[model samples]
Target chain A: MDEEIRARRAACTDTFLGNGLIRPRELLASIDPETDPDTYGEGGVVTELERHVAALLGKPAAVFLPSGTMAQAATLRVHADRRLSRTVVWHPYCHLDQHEGQAHQRLHQLIGRRTGDPEHLIALGDLEEVAEPVAALLLELPQRDLGGALPAWDDLVGQTQWARERGAAVHLDGARLWEASAGYERSPAEIAALFDTVYVSFYKGIGALPGCCVAGSAADVAAVREWRARLGGTLFALWPAAASALRLLDEGLAEMPARMRHARAIWDALAGVPEVRVVPDPPHTPMMHLLFAASAETFRENARRLAEETGLWVWPSGFATGDPDVVRAELSVGRATLRHKPEAIAEILSGLCM
Target chain B: MDEEIRARRAACTDTFLGNGLIRPRELLASIDPETDPDTYGEGGVVTELERHVAALLGKPAAVFLPSGTMAQAATLRVHADRRLSRTVVWHPYCHLDQHEGQAHQRLHQLIGRRTGDPEHLIALGDLEEVAEPVAALLLELPQRDLGGALPAWDDLVGQTQWARERGAAVHLDGARLWEASAGYERSPAEIAALFDTVYVSFYKGIGALPGCCVAGSAADVAAVREWRARLGGTLFALWPAAASALRLLDEGLAEMPARMRHARAIWDALAGVPEVRVVPDPPHTPMMHLLFAASAETFRENARRLAEETGLWVWPSGFATGDPDVVRAELSVGRATLRHKPEAIAEILSGLCM
Candidate 1:
């Protein structure tokens, strides 16, 4: 490949694979360089950003955390303490269970009861079947790894009420709740109000620098703040990344619905491709999985090659199905990715398969 | 107080309490505002900063995380998984056990055996008494809440060997390791080499933005990276604040000893004060506590008032002594806080007592 093409391919792949491409010139235009550090400290810009997020989510307060790991762990820890129970109930595929290095288990000693069937979203019936006394029931809206499937609105409300009746707090693992909101055709506040606490990320659908916020009642948030400090989450200084998030919050949130619409269109277009199979067909949100009649290794190699040739990037690996010859890839249509039409993406996949 | 004075007091208190004030100008000056998003992410300037930290700590790689909570929790989780043991041993005052809301217990389900007397630093003899099969022995170099005391160097090495003999990993809770290194007259790399894993903070003695690094053998760090991502530590980006830490790595590491020297001097001077009694007298590191002839509430109120009047901030709460009239205050002498001479701080305290 020519050097220029390789560089382009690398740039495109880096953007699509990571948080997104940071255009140096564009970012500088938005923020004042001189005040970045101080603007992120106590009573600084990040604090202001937290207030904004709290209000947006209909919560009394919010805190900007460096990562979702600490934010979610801290939130769940508070809930467990308040209930005086160490058991938290959630789907088996919940991020806290699978991704947190068992932090929920290792750091907090909070036991988990996987309340739902593995293959589906948590239903109201699933909540009723859990045998253990749960301190909190975590709901992942538009569940990832399940092709962004969401329980029906009434079912979600019913499940929340079910947990409440049993004196369990409901936490929405809304890491992707931005995208899920579009699927539910509700406002962010509407979705947020359904749970006692909600965790939202700046980087996922919002495309900002990495950060997360946990929003809840004043007392609960104050308790989380204390826990945050104890856990060393209270940094002496925060980067003004939250400033960038404020901008993304304004820019990307409005575009999420359009991205979700585009995702459905992409699903429809790709369904006809002989070599492509999507899970949870017609994805409920702006994300979906594309299974290909190729090994993961082969798919990645081909995807890399295609990027080199076309300056576009697509994931080529995901959960394994039964067949050794097949591989899955997540297709997340963000604002930038949506620039390339669904038909164009389908055509690229078709070319690669051929 | 006049509004202007009140504003000045708040600003000065914020500066005194802030972590990034030491080299804020130089730190902010080095950042490239023109970068797109102007935030931290892979391949961003901040990633370069983490790379520099990894090399300085003699680890194969390092990642910039938001807080020590995630860093320590993630590090311990990796050790537990590798050893298939559920227990971690540490002093009762260790940050993980006391400060993290039992996150190591509640979130990770990792049991902890408090190895030593709470009032003293963990010695080799203390490790000998831990009967359970532990996954890791967590050592806090220059123990904080216990007045920055350290076990003898040989004792630490012996403890590492002791844990290794039992197939357990050794983790150093080196939040104050920078100060501890100066007191021990040892290099950071030398101290890091004694353990399977070590966690260091950028904001504490280093005076950088809030960030931490976990260092170990290549395999151990790789395992931590996997856990980091699983715990949502791997977000969209992490670059800017990490860059600030990188800039401070060279500038701040050497200044710890001066701070320690100042702390010792401060302790010596305060010892002569009629109403003040120093704990762990003569100082082990750049931190000590003053047992005051006042109540905790009175100390806090006075400290807040001093902060308001003198634009100086000192910790106002500590252990309660047997006497109702006496309270303790932790005195941490950092690079910036040491700007005012020891006599000046002691004189301020003497006046406050009168």
Candidate 2:
């Protein structure tokens, strides 16, 4: 629970859920420069990757940016500009609301109006309470903060239509859309079709170097490109990240459905444990939160001890639940989790609780 | 030039004055991951690099950002917030003024008031006429757009004093500070000490990968870091660029003095040519503007022909001179330029003009 013990566990563990802390050369070695000549990210591998992602998302065009924060902000700003409104409606737990330090207001000069409860996904009834004409309504696929829970398909469609009827653009903060798509049992493009602009991250489920692409209409993407340049999101060369993303796209996407199945299997195994509670009851996507009915100190000590003995690393500290007794850890099923069977992990959890 | 001709010329050239459009593998080969592990740019190589840059510039602290555009915008906004002023004063040709598509106004909510003549550097008297209190006075060392021209040191000091006396912060847009330092014949710290915030680019005269560091007081740098995260300038791994920058910093800084000498030598050799006019006459830094007494069409044709014949790639089009009969090219001397002697370049110029 202390800093020294936390440091020791991190230093000793080789287990991480995603792309797992690659060394510079190992990360670079994964990229093929011969097939991916560099540009100022204009017309080389970046453009190729953009086109491929655009096609996959069923959008007219796409532009790659260094981060999802910039991509989403730029996309929503473009949507807002078209409608000449400065207000964006979204759930309070959306990344733009919490993680981005109010850049939506400070940098983009847009005001955010929260529409849904932070602990749950948006409902159709949530849109009816808006008092002003909104520029855009941002929807996060799978509602990451709520353990990747998604609204029902009917409600999802109705939400988009609700915003459209108000002349508000629908934007998707689909940072983990690849993993979420498997839960819906639909192609990414089919889910993406519900939004006017969709921002997907390559780093999360794709296991690529950090980068993202905003896919939308050609005109909108062009505007985002201009904003990308303005936001300093245009890199001198994105080929390295683009090459890595291209290699992961098909592989990562194909693996997601299986990963989701693996997640469900793990959730089912753990459900019988009295000390463990899986958020959303059944896993909605490849990710879900596990809340331990234990103190933070107890959770950290047990996780550290388990890692030291088993060489399987888990987080030392839980994401805050604002409750002293309940500790939360997000389980994102990836190649790393595939190494441990669901039954074994469930047994470990039962042992840790004891 | 025709596509085939351009392709043929490019095949044999070893080019590049500034970092030279690095291929992915070649760039990767230059980095050592074992020594520089991947990070979200926390306390690893990026922190080390930031410390080194801050010390080099004689600042208390520094934070790395993905681009100069973001670095400057964030820095100026930080200054503006402290002063509760939203207006910035700078040269008409400052990068923030010309290149950034008014991101200051659009994103940062800061209005820019252009000062000084675009054809010359800022004079001390120029600051006196500002009718309103300003948030910051941004100075670009070696006034890049005006043939790398710099104001005399006394005038530069007086200009900084003038802004400070008015309770405004002074920020340095030192993208080419390494080369510009040679013009002042002063340590970088000496120049940086004249400003409250200074931004240095790694990809410019340093020839590193694309990135920048803003050096200032610890609090300001911390604010910049916060803005960096908000701007999504925090990469999952910034080690590659940081390592590349550390490699170049000492080498580039050492080479800059000689590079300045080489620039002047080349300028002097070409000064006697009837068709050529070297801006700033003797050259201010390792870069200067070469104006030709020819139309853009003529200049492009001649430069293309020379490249096709000599396997030397000159810019296809000259920088805008506002005169249809005149064209300009900026010559930035570096390791690549060292291969061709000043006399040879002059001879080539003479032949091309003929």
Candidate 3:
């Protein structure tokens, strides 16, 4: 790899690893060829790893899966089955609606009701207004598409109550719950406690290898375990990889407030730029959005050029917004990106725009 | 761990790492502390491993999910859009129906039409009889709940053609495709080429760290990728451990016919045992069902005892069949299981009956 690409990879790894950039050479130094799959057994280290994650999530059990799409869909299916209801309610922009092409509809024969307004958090009023009985209400905390905004604590409590009173289960799409918790000043357990089921990702704020945990009452989770096996989620073995990431990067939860602070600073610095417009301005969580006047293609080209020319990987490319000219870029403040102060980022943005 | 448990663990790891039981310990001989997720990076090796898997699955493209329930459900939802026809059709004993609690109906606003007969494979005749439009048709090769059997190749092709002619897509629940491939004597690519999409698992015939892959044409897989992100499958990173296993154990695919031949041998030998009944006698694939006169619980106890006494694991945990006294055990012969001769397995079964 070229020096620039190598540096970029190191920087990306560093942001995730939460240390100084780990060079390609350093990554090579860590591999053990002897431990390759050709020599391992089933239920060895992998099984122990799965067990640790299950414990951390406070679920009676956990099964390691290949993707969250399978995990969340399966979990929701279990909840729906337990209640014997066919309808699930969530916001219009909820991941299940906007992203999963309706797999639930295609595969499980379930119905999803887009309950709330497109631009706002799902409210209890939306649930109350819906005439059809639902099996579950899925709540995405600090909703990602809406720029990481979460409903108030009372609203969340009321929403849960509203769903339960109607015999529906509440599921928290806590993918970004780590960041959401920082904004709420609530513990993971505290936020998760409100919902009948909670789904949390290991990779996002925690920066572990990609994985997630769905926690709930023992019976509910047990049902999920059975569903997981039927859906082919049960692997022959798992290791402590997710658990190790949880133990190591879980400390990042404590560090999130600082990252959020940094995000706010970056947002503040960039907002003053004539060509830059910030979405959900002031930043509700560690993640914020910057809308550039340039087209997405141009914005991506400029970002790639900056990375190639200056050895800095700032801003992800090709984020979508309703507006065509407004190129959306997420400002996620990890250890590596946080290395350069808001001023440094501002300088780069200004230079790119020029 | 006790010596027995430790030995079991070592054996399992060896199976995953690609060596037979005795050589399993040799896989983990190399270790570097600095790269350990618990010691340095945010989470640990598992998290990193997930990222590698995400990339390998050709997802934009992966998450180390906790279960397939979540993974498949998420993928199904992505396929079933609200404005689109919200229906999925599969066999009667499909994992989503028998296992996932009607999640498709409860979660995605999709309806399920169980099209095929329990005794026969899904045919184009089944698809032609359906009146309502469906979003997708799920095909499980070597249908698990039924005796391990497959539809005629032309029939499978006809089913996919029928579904797509109506603008509906076809999905292959190839959980046991490896065995099915051996039975069919076709390549994975050849089998996969038939459907609009396919879901394959790593742990079954491959005997790797548990993982799965959903592959399709670029556009279809691309859509699944987007859904994966929305459903929380987009973890920050992934563990390469499962990928490592895939790299190593995929070679076993070439050797599957040998295993299938051995499975038939075991089936033939067991047919002579008075108390034991084999389904699809002589074996349709490498896996076969051995029904016993005891109940599932009794069968489990006996199997456990047998495992304790002799280092062999023969599974006959009763499934959702009608007979109470019947215990169903699947004989899935891998390289390790094949180590013992068919007569040896038969001798063990004879002892269990006494």
Best by lDDT: 2
Give me candidate 1's interface root-mean-square deviation: 5.9
lDDT (Cα, 0-100) at B306 in candidate 3: 61
Candidate 3 lDDT, tens digit per residue, B1-354? 344545544334222111245332232222232333222112455445444444433433333343455456555655666227888888888888777666566555567788868767788788889988788888888887666777778887888888888888777787788788888888766787777666767656665545565665555555655554544344443334334343544477778898889878887788778787777765777777667777667766775666565555444245645788776666667777677778877777665554
Q: DockQ values for all predictions?
A: 0.29, 0.57, 0.18
Segments of candidate 2 deviating more than 4 angstroms: A1-10, A35-39, B1-12, B19-21, B35-39
lDDT of 2 by residue, A1-354 (tens): 344553554465465354443455566666785755545667667889999999999999999999988888888889888986889999989899998888888777788999877787888878888889899999999888888998888899999999999999999999999877999999999999999899999878777778899999999999999999888887776777888889878988999988888889988898789788998889889888888888888887887787778776677667767888888888777766766789987877665555
Interface RMSD of 2: 3.1
Error of 2 at B246 (Å): 1.7
Ranking 2 against 3 by DockQ, winner: 2
Alpha-carbon TM-score of each model against the true structure: 0.74, 0.95, 0.64
Q: How are the candidates ranked when ordered by DockQ, highest leading?
A: 2, 1, 3
| RMSD in order of candidates | 6.0, 2.4, 8.3
Give the DockQ-based CAPRI class for model 2. medium
Ranking by lDDT: 2, 1, 3
Give the per-residue lDDT digits (tens) of candidate 1, residues A1-354.
344433454477333332345454344334444543433236656777888999889888888876787788878889999886888888888887786677677556688888778888888777777867789989998888787888899999999998898899999989898888889899889999999999998877876666788999988888877766655556666645666677678678888888888888877888789798777787888887777887766776777776666556555334577888787777777866676677777777765554
For model 3, the local distance difference test gives: 0.64
Model 1 lDDT at residue B136 = 94
